[model samples]
Target: MSFLSALRRPPAAVRLNASYRATPCRSVSTSIPAASDKPAKASATATHTISSCTEGTVLGGLNWLKGQAPVTALADEEYPPWLWKLLDPKVIPDDGPGGQGEKVRLRKENRKKIRDVQFMKTQ
Candidate 1:
């Protein structure tokens, strides 16, 4: 038989379910409160600011339930004057002898080279 003629034929037998249990209905309270009677407020009071420690560094996170805002990171392109002053060694004291200096020096040395792969091919 041709493809079009085969498609027009109906299949053998079809089974159908006549009954099924539907979902249970939820009952709601019909009692209504008076306009003058206010709803009870939250039981426990929240702290606006809470001090916390992270890896020996002191930091603060906000408690939004008390209506305080959280601190955010400064954008990569934006450099504040106070931040520049902070970066200067004379202002912020360096950690003793062999700590952060080596990592900072390595990063500075690596940054001096051209990063693009196209530049690497020329050399």
Candidate 2:
């Protein structure tokens, strides 16, 4: 018997469906900036060097990836809740860390600077 079946686990399809239902998808803007200063030809040429492997090659690699228990392998509750949370996209928070501060520090360094300035003013 398969390990999953031996463990009396739910089928992969059912787990995937439950995970999909629990995750909320945010719209990702794919529009490119038209006002970029870089020359279009140069950017296009740079992009040409970045490539995806053949679908067959990717599929072949999946067996190894699956064996390694790739990122989403935590549909099983036997794993830690943290891993389960990460794998379940439906648990995504709209205002979670990645939602903002992509290029910014979330910490309020400004507050520290303000406090320093106030201390100086009082002194």
Candidate 3:
């Protein structure tokens, strides 16, 4: 009998639905003792200390340019008209003869008509 069958694992349908592997997966074993075998861990408390400012400080030689650049706000003129529609639906003018849902339905119908026309055309 197979290892899985000996263990009386769940049915193949259940196993297949889950994270199933054709071959048994190998797990890495460490040399450390199990929790039950090992002694209880002692509580560790960290002690903080502020070091003295010495002349041989490592952070001194770093290159940092001390200057500020002029910051300008991005205007609507800088953005494309389509981007405004994405940022806010209300900002976009629905100039067409129908609403948003109507436009989507028309688009889908147009795609189907194009597909039908293409299908009718030769290979």
lDDT of 2 at 78: 42
lDDT of 2 by residue, 1-123 (tens): 755243334336545675433222221223333445677644432211111222222111123334573222222334454532332334334464576442134445767788899999998
Ranking by lDDT: 3, 2, 1
Against the reference, the lDDT scores of all candidates come to 0.37, 0.38, 0.43
Worst 10 residues of 3 by lDDT: 54-63
Write one digit per residue (lDDT tens) for candidate 3, span 15-108: 6765542333222322433345334632333322222323233321122354434222243355465532432334434666787766877898
> Residue 52: error of model 1 in Å?
41
Error of 3 at 5 (Å): 35
Candidate 3 off by > 4 Å: 1-97
Tell me how far the alpha carbon of residue 21 in candidate 3 is from the true structure, in angstroms, after superposition: 6.9
Query: TM-score of each candidate?
Result: 0.20, 0.18, 0.23
TM-score for predicted model 3 compared with the true structure: 0.23
Q: Total clashing residue pairs per candidate?
A: 0, 3, 0
Q: Say which prediction, candidate 1 or candidate 2, comes out ahead on lDDT.
A: 2
State the lDDT at 6 in candidate 3: 32
